[model samples]
Target: EKRAFLAQSPQLYKQICALAFEKVFMIVPVFRAEKFDQPTHLNELRQMDIEQAFASDEEVMNALEECLAYILKEVREKCEEELEVLGQRIEIPRLPLRRIPYSKAIEMLREKGEEIEYGEDFSKSQERLLWKIVKEEAFFITQWPEELKAFYAMPYEDNPKLVKAFDLIYRGLEISSGTQRIHDPELLIKRIKEKGLDPKNFEFYIDCFRYGSVEHAGWSIGLERLTMAITGRKNIREVCLFPRDRKRIFP
Candidate 1:
C-alpha cells in the first residue's frame, strides 16, 4: 500500500504485463480514499482487472465484456443458494453492450429539461437524473473529454480533445471506466504534467516503460457497485459484508 497507492484498476499491472505476457488478468483488493460512506463506497474493495496487449481498445472491451458475461452467468448458476439467501438475481447481459458518448448523454439530458454545460463532468445529481431515465441499460459511454478522464486513457487520434476512454454504466451508476492506456513514455509524462500530478513521485512506474511496453487496455469494476447492481441496491453500503465509512473506522 505504501509503494503502490491502491490503483483503482490494474493500469500499472497491464503496462508491466505488456512487456512479457500478451494477455493478463489481475484481480486484487484496491484501496480508494473515498470521502463518503455511501452504500457503494468502500475504502478497500475487490477489483477485477483484465488487460490485453496487441489489441485495440475496442477488442479489449469486447474481451472484458465477454468475460463478465460468462462470469455473471456462471455465478448465478453456481451460487443459487447464496443468491436465494440474499434475495438477489443476476441477469447476464449479452455481448456488445450499447456504447454511448458524452455528447449524446448531454443531449438526452437536455431533452429531459436539465441545464448542463458541455465541458463539465457529470455531477452526482446529474448521474441520478441519468439513472432515473436509463433504467436497466447495461451500456458503455465512450469518447469522453480528455480532461474528464484519468491521465492513462489514450487520447483520440482524430480528436485530441477526447480520449478513447469508456465508462460502463450498469442499471444507472458508473461501474467501471476503461481505455487504451498511454504506453509512450514521453506522452505519458506530458499527460501527467498536464494533470497537475508530479512525475517524480511515479518514477518506479516510469522506470518500467523504459525497458519495454506495448499498447494495452483494461478496466476495473467496483466490487460494491457490482454487488449493488446484482442486489438492486441504490446505496452502496447495503451490499457490503461489513461497512466502513469516513465516519466509522473500527469494526
Candidate 2:
C-alpha cells in the first residue's frame, strides 16, 4: 500500500532543507482537496514558501515586508500597461506594515460593531472589516492562540497559551501566514500529542529535530492571491488562465 499525500504546501520540504542551507526558498505547485468553489480558491495552485534558520518570527516578518515592497515596485514599472487592461493600479505598500495583536484586533472589531470573540479565527467578511478599520493595504495580525495554530508553531515564552505566529492580511485577504517553528524534538512531540495527533505518524519529520535542529521561521505566499490583490481582481479565476476547482479539471 502506498502511503503518501498530495503535498498541500512545500512547508515541510523547505524546512528540511533549512537544516543545512540556513536559508531556502521555493515556488512550486501545491494540491488541495477542498470542496469550496469560491471565487478565490482552487484545487491546484502555486505557492512561494520560504524558510530560514536561526531566525525569529519578527526577523522573518521584516524580510517579508521588504520583499513585498520590491514586488509592488517592480510590478508598477513593468506591468503598467497590463494593469491598465485590468483597470488596476499597484499601490506600493509602506515599509513595516502595521502589526496588530490578535486580542487587540478583536477589540477593534468589537468597537466597530463586530461580535467576534477572542481565540476565534476571522471569517472573510470580518477580514474585510478589519482591513477597513486599519486603513492599510497590508498589515499583520500576530500572537494567535496556540490552539488556533498548528502544533509546529512556537509558543511565546511569556504566554505559552499564545503562539509566535502571524498572518499577513492584504486588502481584506490573507496573502500569507507563518510562525517560528518548534525545533526542540521533545517539545515538538509534546505539541503533536497535545493536538491529538500521533507523533509516530510524523516520526520522520520529528526525528529531524532530534540531533541539532536550529530555531527557524518561515511563511508561504500564494501566487494566485497576490495576483488577485495586485490586479484588483474580485475572482481568482479571472487571473488564472486555467484554474482547477471543484468543477473544472482540464484545459
Candidate 3:
C-alpha cells in the first residue's frame, strides 16, 4: 500500500461506531476526488453520513424524514426571509413517500420513448421524467437491484434480484440513499468480490462482523444538494459559501 484514500466523512468509521452504538449520526466533510462541474457536483462537499444497526430500511428513512422535518420547522419559524426567497414553506411530509422500483421507473420512461437498459441507474434526464409526475413528492422509491446499487445494500427477500435499498428523491434530485446492509461477513465479502474489487482493502471493515455486530441500517443525505433545493437555487455553487469546482476554486 503506497498511498491510500482517507474518507472525509465517517461512513466506514460510523459503521464501526454502530457496532458499539446501534444508532449514530455524523455531519462531516467528505472528500471526493472526482472532477466536478455541475452546480451540485463539487470535488469536496459536506455530507450527513448516518448508519443505524438493528433497524430496517424503512425505519432509517423515517429517521431521516424526522431530521429533515425538524430542520425545516426551525427554518420556517426563524428564517422567514430565506424561505420567502426560495418560495418554500412546508411542514412535515406524509408518513410514507412514493416508492417505485428501478424496473418500474424504467418502464414508465420507456413509455415516454426512452429505451433504458436493465440494471442501469437513472440519468438526469431520466430522473426529470419521473420528477414531472412526482414534483410535489417527499417520498422515496426503493428496492434497486443489487447490481445497480453499491456493495453495501442488503439483498431483498423473495427478490434476490433486488437489494433492500432506496433513494430519497425530492424536487427531482436524489437527496439521500439509505438501505439495509449485509451484516453477514461472508455476504459482504461476496458482494465485494462480485463488484470486481479486492477484499483486502475492506479487511478492517470486515473485521466488524468477525467480532459481534448488530443488524442496523442507515442513510446519508448530501448537505449541499439539500441547500440547493431548499434555496431554490438552480446551480449548486450558489448554495455553498465557497464552492470549489473543477474550473473555479478561488473565492
Best by TM-score: 2
State each candidate's clash count: 4, 0, 6
> What TM-score, to 2 decimals, does candidate 3 have?
0.92
Which regions of candidate 2 fall more than 4 Å away from where they truly are?
Answer: none
State the lDDT of candidate 3 residue by residue for 1-251, as single tens digits: 58877575576678888879877878888777776456568877888878887898888888877877777678778889878877886555665666787777878888889878888888866776788766654657787878888787889778777998998876677888878888889989999999999999999999888887777888889999987767777888788888776776687
lDDT of 2 by residue, 32-147 (tens): 99998787788999998899999999999998888888989999999889989988878888888999999999999999899887889998788889999999989999999999
- Summarize candidate 1's per-residue lDDT along 1-251 as a digit string, tens digits: 45645465557756787667877877787766878655557787777777778777798778767866886888899989988988877888876887778998898789899889887877656666776766644777788999988888889889989998888877677777788988888888999999999999778887887877777787777767877877677777777766666876677
Error of 1 at 14 (Å): 3.5
Instruction: Name the top lDDT candidate.
Output: 2
Per-candidate TM equals 0.87, 0.96, 0.92
- What is the descending lDDT order? 2, 3, 1
Candidate 3 overall lDDT versus native = 0.79
Give the worst 10-residue stretch by lDDT in candidate 3.
89-98
- RMSD (Cα, Å) for all candidates, in order, is 2.7, 1.2, 2.0
Candidate 1 residue pairs in backbone clash: 39-236, 39-237, 40-236, 40-237
